[model samples]
Target: MGILHTLSLLFITTPLLLLLLEENVSNVEARDHHHFGKKQKIKNSPKLSPAYSPAPAPSPRYPPSIPSDPSYGPTPTDYNSTRNCIFDVTDFGAIGDGATDDTAAFRSAWKAACQVENGVVFAPSDLVFMITSTIFSGPCQPGLVLQVDGVLMPPDGPDCWPKSDSNKQWLVFYRLDDMTLTGTGTIEGNGQKWWDLPCKPHRGPNGSTLPGPCDSPALIRFFMSSNLVVSGLRIQNSPQFHMKFDGCQGVLIDKLSISSPKLSPNTDGIHIENTKSVGIYNSVIGNGDDCISIGTGCSDVDIEAVTCGPSHGISIGSLGVQHSHACVSNITVRNAFIRDSDNGLRIKTWQGGTGSVTGISFENIQMENVRNCVIIDQYYCLTKACRNETSAVYLSDVTYRNIKGTYDVRSPPIHFACSDTVACTNITMSEVELLPYEGVLVDDPFCWNAYGLQETLTIPPIDCLQDGMPLSLAENSSYAC
Candidate 1:
């Protein structure tokens, strides 16, 4: 070898090595700034285009600034910059290998993040974290954020589920206030094995569920929380309800996608109970059970601009079960689209129930091929053996406005079977147009003991509505208003 040959080789290789180092540095910087509200650029390499920018950070639409009623207690504000307060799960010994259990690492990271103001529990990108049945309880710092830019999942199924834990819920956030959980992440509830259990509905002969232990868990739940915001996440295949809010107030959930197979039993998209001042906006949800079911003690709740399909459309009841007293009011659902669902808008209460349901509204809704576009049944029994009773939940001041849709011919487009003892009052409907899907009406609006005022002409012409208030408002003992 000659000196000239060695010198030429060194000169050529040095520039190439320097270029590789520069590209690698850019990649590292981009990863560091991911989803943390920062900007970083990447230089071109063999794989990517020249000077490419990665996906943008998580936006500040956590509690979405929109028009709302003043009754909604408080909305969560934007989070403070959390560059120094990041508690990465990997730093606490998380493997992120998708198979190994990382439950302890997640808990530890949350605990540390909850202690500081504007603390961030960050699950970085390009990794998969597997956790178990865990609770993220808090009454801690106000501006906490959980940014999951990675894949989060649980154990494979019932066989791998933790035996010592309760099967009611997988992840719970209790007593949180002014917290924001927004991410461009995925939370995959590995629920196929649980869904295949014998106790699930329709898994037996002739549409009968088999006899077995049938305790499925909700994937994410928030209990006793206030001023919470959740947005910009994709959740799928939950064991039960995808997300539930129990006894929560001033909540805002938007830009979320929740889905499951239509055959997956009892997979409600989102269920809320005893929650107040909630706003669910601009989300898409499809599952087996109700897309959104509001239970007892919910009030001042507003749902707008949601798309639901392959779902049981939004419901306001099945309330006052077991002859209990239930008082729900001031719930409004508007500007929604539902397609191929069992029911479009329903309010059902059990017989022999006490208390009253008032000030409910469903407006500006569009439906396609729905079975029951409008229904109000005072006899909401799951089993066919429900005994008839004399007393009933007092119903009044309910309005359905501008609801246009197409329906299936199996059931009537509008059905109102009110209580025998305490009749419904002020049940108003205006501009409701419903027609059979590519067919004629096999059944008209089925009404029984319902009384209201028809301000405008109906599609099927509800002549059964007795045009006045029912005497239950003044005569019934259970009526509140």
Candidate 2:
């Protein structure tokens, strides 16, 4: 009718303008698929981010009775059947030039790589063997291994080596058996040029005012060894006694890392004289003296998981003269952690000396800021003019179970001074706790007829001796207190 009604409104506005041009091309292809998925998520963001992760972390839950204690056992043998020989002190031509005396090419490469049978004398990987006195004579046949991977340097500058009375132990492992001293080595005892060598005005076996001839020479001297094993070493700056194990047997000093520099004189870190079944586990002795010094014929000794600080704790004797022997007996120092040490647990005896210190035990120790945390010096070499001697030795069955923390109220956490003539018998302090710095609560005494004023000394009143009372002495003598 009007040209078919204007072509029926041009086919109904040409199907509504092709449905609004396909809805604006689907909103411009969903805005170009949301900018191409944000440029492919910023080009795959560094492969899902995490630059350097070689993977390793998450292994620390210790306390399965803290590793079954026989001094944290198990490691008798089979360290890969052991046999690692490598020795290279600059290819046996070691010329650190310090006057060139490489000690017979390091004792003929340590007796030809410790003469076979389970050998291990590997000391290569970057050499430095300027030695002076190196004697490792031994019967090290049963699984022999002395792997000190480079560095036994000593004689550098100090008047071209002057200190002499002929005793400069850089490393002398005498009378050995199952030996071992692993890699990442170093035994540098240049010892401040032997502690500035000038104190030889001697004449004292008791001459009253003249002492000075141990100037320096004892970095490592283990005489009479047995199934010995010293692992992962680092013995440094020792002018004297950094590690001395005289008369040893079945010893095992593991992961040792000793340091010396707190007025470093007579640096006694590991001194176990007259040893028997000894074991110093996971060490780090910071020395001046006795980080571990159990002198006078030690027996079944065991110091577990150690870490004594600033040194001088765990001593069992200044004991006796004429060495009447028998100072340390079946001992056990467990789960140790002494800090700022100076006698966390000591039993020093030497007012005269006779010997019979019985079964000692200090368990679960964890001292901090220590300074004589618990001490017993019958009269340990009493310095500065004070001598009322008398100790024909006898500190019996001593035990300080589960000692815990903090000390130093001018040093008197517990001081037992017995032996005016033997009277420190069967002492025991269970679950001992002293946190003094002026918080005083001191009542734990056991002195006993101290000097024997004809024996009438009795003590049994610390809450009726903590519930299980029974301490009677001569005039009767019972037990359990």
Considering every candidate listed, which one attains the maximal TM-score?
Answer: 1
Please list the Cα RMSD from the true structure of every candidate, rounded to 1 decimal place: 19.0, 32.1
Worst 10 residues of 1 by lDDT: 24-33
Model 1, position 53, has a per-residue lDDT of: 21
Candidate 2 Cα outliers beyond 4 Å, as residue runs: 1-85, 90-120, 123-129, 132-179, 182-217, 221-239, 242-315, 319-329, 332-347, 350-377, 382-384, 387-394, 398-423, 427-481
Q: Can you write out model 2's per-residue Cα lDDT over 287-332, one digit (the tens) per residue?
A: 7666887877878877776777787776776666433544568888
Q: lDDT for every model?
A: 0.75, 0.57
Which has the greatest lDDT?
A: 1
How many clashing residue pairs appear in each of the predictions shown?
A: 0, 1
Error of 1 at 77 (Å): 16
Which digits, one per residue and each the tens of the lDDT, describe model 1 over residues 431-462? 88876765455434777788898999987688
TM-score of each: 0.83, 0.31
> Candidate 1, residue 49: CA error in Å?
47
